[model samples]
Target: MTLSAQTKVGPAGLISDLQSLGLRLEDNEVGVTGRRGGAGPSDHKAVSLAGRTVMIPIATVSACESPFVASRPDANGISEIRRNGVVVSHIEFPRQPRFYDLQTTEGIPYSQIATLHSSDVLATTLLQSCIRYGNRNTSCQFCAIGQSLSAGKTILRKTPEQLAEVAKAAVELDNVKHMVMTTGTPNLTDRGAALLCESAEAVKAVVDLPIQGQCEPPDDDIWFERMKAAGIASLGMHLEAITPEVRARIMPGKAGVVLERYMDAFDAAVAVFGRGQVSTYILAGLGDTPDVILSVSEQLITKGVYPFVVPFVPITGTPLENHPAPTPAFMAQILPQLGAMLKKANLLSHDMKAGCAKCGACSALASYEV
Candidate 1:
């Protein structure tokens, strides 16, 4: 059923639609600058709607054919969002960060080291290369982690000093609230913990912003303590797909680690990061039924871990580029139930110190929490 101009949709519904179907810009002026083809919420632009910012997909194939469209921004930097030629809402795009103009003393651009995520979060991939990404049999089918590296949009490795430099400038210039550092799986041993710790420590040395470090479970649980001591305020270990079959089918090599290992790791990391501070990302449109997603989410909440469920976006240049994203109706079924559960557990996205769940831009789950 197509929505007509008379249909009434709230902020949560609008966010869900924009994320799933994406927004087609009627004019190029609306999105003069935005992220494209990189790690951590690629091909998205931060759109401020209903007093909160969201990372809406704008570069996907689905966006080109979406029912939602945005007109050029007025002098006040606000644009009108229309559905079937009916004005539904007005939105604002975050201006390009001030830090993007500066470079390290060595001449490496700060934008190349760390980019602004959501509206105020500074995000960077410590290592652009991933072990699984190099092999088709092992890589996550939905990943485009290598595209930015290949396109020269980002550097392969960001040194601790360089990260600290960019992080400080972002805080001072852009008023960046926190930092999110995610790395591709470097190896099976530390699983990128060592680099995250080093980067966090360096960033903390020069800035006071909170930091979230995301990676696979490290072989030794002691790394959690090391990370906390290094000034990491929160942690994220993503379970992009919940079911074993889907995990194996979508990310075969990652599946080898097994769900048991992830559970154990989550318990240990939660012990270090504290309740509500340790979180996991669950992608909703990746063949997991609502029951399966809710069941896993309940388990995570029981263990005091926040389960952030987001719609699956088919990034271009990846194996699943042609895969269809979840419909707004599909997300509607899950988000409300999950939001109620989080309320019952006293877990809220706003209370989070830093990270994707805290940013709450890639998913509309945050809006439902209210």
Candidate 2:
């Protein structure tokens, strides 16, 4: 028997393959569309590639429909394009965590605080609320943090003990491998980094999984060292956009964090976490040109930071929900250049040791480029 073709392909090819799998991609101002249940014109669903389900609005899909996709989209945009009724390059959807079945002693849902990502990684918004989430003048246009919270799916503040309990259960029952603690910016001296450390320490005391913490650069560079000491194996200080104008328009609140400050934090994190352990997320197709992304990625690689570039897929209820994902052709065009930068700097995703992009689940850029 011959194995199904595993050659890498681009976005257009990915969509075509998915269409052949009985999945349809309906172009909408709200991104790609598909159908899950008994089909009809009104049955088309809006969905996210994150976990690959026909995530129709709550009003559309029956509550009985699986909330998560049985198979997810590959980094190149291919779905289950099977041959001879056998799956190829199958992408597994994250299994819902057992922790979701429990609640904090305070009666808060565990899922509300920190939920599982990629089946084995625990991710949470320590503070579900961001100062930016409410202010159109300040919020990252693409963020749905507040929308999810308002929908009663998550909590605003998660206690350290609560995080510890969930972490313990997730690791023991679900085979969780790592933890990611992120937060909305609080009007405090340490920004959200200090709270992340407290949560990291709490989770560390009970579980031994590698931990990654994401936050803006704090006012003090010393906080990076503090985080490393707190059992965090790696750090993510995201510079979501590369250009000043885009920064201001996309994330007014985060844009206040000067580029120099981020560079400083990246340098500090590298010193503490070692090369390849420090990373930043660069979202392509957010009105940024390939030239700009390549230039910024080159600089990040030179500084010993892994630049994890991903296509910007706008989520529903966010300001950019209507925005289209970057064409796969665009991603393919730039990934080679960005990947070369990684090779030159010796910053490979496998070298990240542990983290989101390192897992190579979100973007196929790593699998293809590396």
Candidate 3:
């Protein structure tokens, strides 16, 4: 039943290890119900697995003072545990970047636009306010993109020049290797892809770092080509949920873009960024059945898109805070299927060149398979 032996284990073993960490399996999804002591959303839960904690929704673990739990034998905020009584340690959480304290000459907060994750890559949402957030009925249920803006923690927009300045400082001072530029949907003809292109061009003006740009697919396929010409090395067009019903329920605003548009975007991006350079995020435990997710992943792979499947760890302040995280068992079942698909497609994470999936910090699926 030992799950982490550098070799894949059965789904049941993954389930057992998660249950040992106080997780529950409901409707074939693994999750837990508890409060981390926050202001809003009292019923939020932490997504823990194999004794390690993933994302705890903002409502669940919002404040820095919130009471959260770490499993025994903690390793720098991550937990470690044994399946079949063989213990394995978890990876360490990367430290917060030092560049956050610095500000641009215009007195703009640098951290407002971008922040570091997993301790190395510099990630930014150039446009903090999403038009979708204005419509309560249509916004992505799991997004807190505008919540930070409402809290006055970030700015409404960031210019390419400002982003370029920050990238320079982050690379020179923090040794950042890669950069991720994502945006809130702007009501524009290019669907925010053009803005990402501008930012990528500016950043490339300062450094030759690997850059990944994510957005809803542009209305025209040609934007993918433009993005590549602008110095963007990779592309991520996230299909958060594969099922139509799930998409409507969890991401009404984003769902309007339709799966066909995302598929088209991915295909065009694959042609521009190349196969392994194009990816999409498929969130687990969002009401999509494993069969459904697997089927969608297969189609995506056939079209040359890497399905970056992540557990649905609800964010606080969002509608899904009360929602649960997918169990290790669920991830284990899906990871092998995804791995086999990738193997057949001749796509590998190591070939991605750079990005979140390439970093392999958010989920253990990449390490478990590739």
Assess each prediction's global lDDT (C-alpha) against the native.
Answer: 0.90, 0.66, 0.67
| Candidate 3 Cα outliers beyond 4 Å, as residue runs | 1-93
Candidate 2 lDDT by residue in tens digits, 270-326: 999998999888878788888888888888888899888766655545667556556
TM-score, every prediction: 0.97, 0.79, 0.80
> What's the CA error at residue 333 for candidate 1, in Å?
1.0
Return whichever of 1 and 2 wins on TM-score.
1
* Candidate 3 C-alpha error for residue 345, in Å: 2.6
Question: How much is 264 displaced in model 2, in angstroms?
Answer: 1.9
Q: Write the per-residue lDDT of candidate 3 for residues 146-189, one digit (tens) a residue.
A: 66677776687888999998999899889988888888888746
lDDT of 1 by residue, 278-343 (tens): 999999899999999999999999999999999999898898888999999999889989999999
Question: Candidate 1 — worst ten consecutive residues by lDDT sum?
Answer: 1-10
Residue 186's C-alpha lDDT in candidate 1?
A: 95
Error of 3 at 248 (Å): 1.4
